[model samples]
Target: MLITEKKHGIRFAQRMSDLGTETAFVVLAKARQLESQGRTIVHLEIGEPDFETPAHIVDEAVRALKAGATHYGPSPGLPEARQAIARYVSETRRVPVDFERVVITPGAKPIMFYTILALVDEGDEVIYPNPGFPIYESVIRFVGGRPVPIQLHEENDFRLDVGELLDLVTDRTKLIIINSPQNPTGSILTAEDLEAVGRLALDRDIYILADEIYSRIIYEGDFTSILHVVPEAMDQVILLDGMSKTFAMTGWRLGWGVMQPTLAAAVAKLQTNSNSCTATFSQMVIPPALFGPQGPVEAMRAEFQRRRDAIVAGLNRIDRITCRKPAGAFYVFPNTSRLGVDSQTLADRMLQEAGVAALSGTAFGRFGEGYLRFSYANSIENIKLGLERVEAFVAKL
Candidate 1:
């Protein structure tokens, strides 16, 4: 007898239905498939850095591995790694962060997952930005919390509207997710904006999860953390950051969270039950990556700024497409509403016809329907080529 669904019962739990996916990875697979079929795809679909890991950071990890540093570490993280994160956060944010408050995970994502799991009760609400990271909503729903989306307007350059966000709050609201130098849109929230949000969270006694993974990838101005603005509300804030964007260490899978010691204990317990701990050698890389030469990171940011400028200019010259120069990150969310096609259809047509791999804005959320997101993480030549293909495809419409 064949093993078939009809012959054997196989079902996912109820919460599985509510879980969503990050469509960038899905588009990447399709792009790779097309490439395997001999199509030349200019990939702007994923947000990963195109650079290699810095030499020093890689050397540190290698040294640790060679010296037999591979062992089961503490659930929260190796003590030295946690201490380095504490120092990094304290110095950078100008807020004193105790080492006890830091918890390391495989990547920045687990911080999001663990924070939601530990804090959100079923029926509690989480207010997060739409056209934001899909996993924010995905993990929110996975843990049985209601996801309340706050629309990010293109007119406002995709910054979160504090007034509008205030309207979404309810007694059941447990946490608010803030992603500055945000994904997809690449907008940075102002210090005043962070102050307002911090005040709201403090007054309402709700938690604020600040996802600042892209803090080191900024352009044009200083990057501000919520903790910097509201050090008084340290207990109410959870800071999420990682080496993926900064040091081109996505493959290394190292990230961390900084919170109050009590909540850190809770998140660490969750880590114990789940991932146990991050890799020991990877943990050893933290001190060097944070305190080592800053030259490599600055070079990457400068290059990304160059790519951002080129992509924005190219997209603007195309008919019916208007793009804003993002303040940070490596994405340009161009408005395609004037082209009279839904974002998903436009994205699909671009991929199938033009060999350009980009994401429909709807992949972020329903509010993203009129837009499309293209990561400028590729080379300037590839970015220009993708723009040409997009323009040619849009002209046909």
Candidate 2:
């Protein structure tokens, strides 16, 4: 029988207490609870893509399963799958992606863990964005690394201030995280900005952990990848990417980390010990997904662009809520602080009383205070309804 607190008085490790969680999942659970109580919630909380995984990718997975590809495989990933990822990254980042330097994991998440853990010793300082993805902060803390947050500016359209970022770096700083077409804010860093960070990392000999999951979900201007910006300094780079956002394959749980050969080998060993590779059948479908026609992918991006416009326009109509037009990704973070209300209160009231689901900006970071994130990943009808209810609720308050 499995040991449990009830049965054996199990004392969890002390480290477990230090771990943090993604509040999006917490908000999702609460939304579900209210939904079960017969509330009609127009969900704008989670960043999930409501679209189905493309038919071609689905067909490939089905074919792989039928062909008896359901067993455990190499932890670093199948050779053909790695080659396909290498091709995609090489084309997108303009860096010569070595297939051997790619280590496949269940999702982009594992790459974050592996890369951070591989580079960060206890007491090492890591610089990540404030008001950025919550998991980056959570994982750094969980691993005993000192997380130094660089506050992203709203006046700068949520772009990282190169001066501020460089000032925070010190001898203790080991890694700096770069997430373009970033989460929550949907801000894309400029190519020049990326090159500046690359120069800093090169001078300090610090690693750059680049999260480029939403590279293909871009709408305005171009997506400037870190590898493409400073290809010469790639030795200090670790690229994290996957199919979840781009291909609407969130549940497929497939992602890869591209790094120097030594780090890739170490990550593979870590994966072999822990995750034991992505599902065998999922790996079989990756090459087809990478090399196949991209009509469905382009269609999805166009639709997201349309939704992005609707949400930004709708939120702007509410005088108290000022949402910037995002360049990429599918979220709009509006400043609700103009109304003299905390983000948590506004988000909870919208869900519990107004039947609209949204996340408080504080759920991301303290720097995200005075803001609220609304995901446009849902349908246009629902996005309109969700924002309408929010507008009505804010009007009453």
Candidate 3:
């Protein structure tokens, strides 16, 4: 009787039982803890830009707050903000979008989730890229949809094979996800690939979600959006873009989704029920950010290009590592298999032994086993130091 005990806590939803997670933040937290203990940790694990938000953007937010823009606005977003987004998309991406089709959310992630929720049903097939953003797969599973992987090979510069992708689509497929200037690998989809997939989407009447968050961070050839190839896809295509990457406004939580009117309404309903709306003051910054002078953005892009060149050159000098100069985005996904260790093991050893923190390829997907993603969004000095530490660690091994 004395040993008898009460029952433990009740079970949570079974859908959440096998949910996956993004590992970038976990590695970031561990790096911070190590730094707190007096360790000099060179962080290459996170995807955030190292620069501050532009002064004009910040000032706009402050002005909005002071001008009494604190009240709850529409759940979809402020009309002015939506109009600015629409205009920006039309001018930049060449996609003629009506302002009524735009829905501003807290960040790009919400748009992904909302789009997935609207299209995916139980057991419905959804195609997404492996070695891509982890959240795409996670959210697909969260909504009881079957996630089909479109394998991206390192030999192909991590770009998707459109023929192979189309071969995997079935009659039950409801949605397909694509990311350009992709995360982790930083591969940009080719115009040919985009055209093939765009035609497929049009023929199959399937919904397409294009994650173009890093559209402005390219280092080489012109950056292209799928919207450019399929201008008529304004209704079926949902384009996700934001100030987070382009303007370094991650903390501001400003992002907008461009979709057809009906889909936009659905997403707005979701917002109304969940987040209510994005922060009022943040919405006020969209106009200035969209139409302001392009000086800061160009400066940041030039700096990122320099850092990319430095990291790629340094990694190429290491005998045991192979990396390509990423076409866009602020990451270098190098194949670490020549080091005689798996990515996760190498990442763990590097963090604890070399005082250099980075993300394992396994954190992205199973296809990412032999690679590790190093974000070059830090200072050039830090990038050089991190590579040196990594080289030393490989030598000792």
TM-score of each: 0.98, 0.97, 0.97
Q: For residues 252-343, what per-residue lDDT tens digits would candidate 3 score against the true structure? A: 89898999899899999999999999999999999999899889998999999999999999998988788988999999999889889988
Provide the clashing-pair count of each candidate structure: 1, 0, 0
Q: lDDT per prediction?
A: 0.93, 0.90, 0.91
Kindly report which residue stretches of model 2 are placed more than 4 angstroms away from their true locations once superposed: 1-10
Candidate 1 local lDDT, 61-123, one digit each (tens): 889999999899999999999999999999999998899999999998999999999999999
lDDT per residue for candidate 2 within 1-397, as digits (tens), equals: 5545356565899778767878888888999998898888888888878999999899999999999998989889999999999998898888898899898899899999899888898899999988999888888888899999998889999999999997899999999998989998999999889999999999999999999999999997678898888998898999999989989988999999999999999999999889778898998888888889899889999999999999899999986889899999888889998888898998888888899888899888899999999889899999888878888888988
- Model 1 ranges with Cα > 4 A deviation: 1-6
* RMSD of every prediction: 1.1, 1.7, 2.1
Indicate the TM-score of model 1.
0.98
The TM-score measured for candidate 2 stands at 0.97
Question: Which candidate achieves the best lDDT against the true structure?
Answer: 1
Winner of 1 and 2 under TM-score: 1
| Residue pairs with clashing backbones, model 2 | none
**Model 2 C-alpha lDDT versus the unseen true structure:** 0.90
Alpha-carbon lDDT of model 1: 0.93
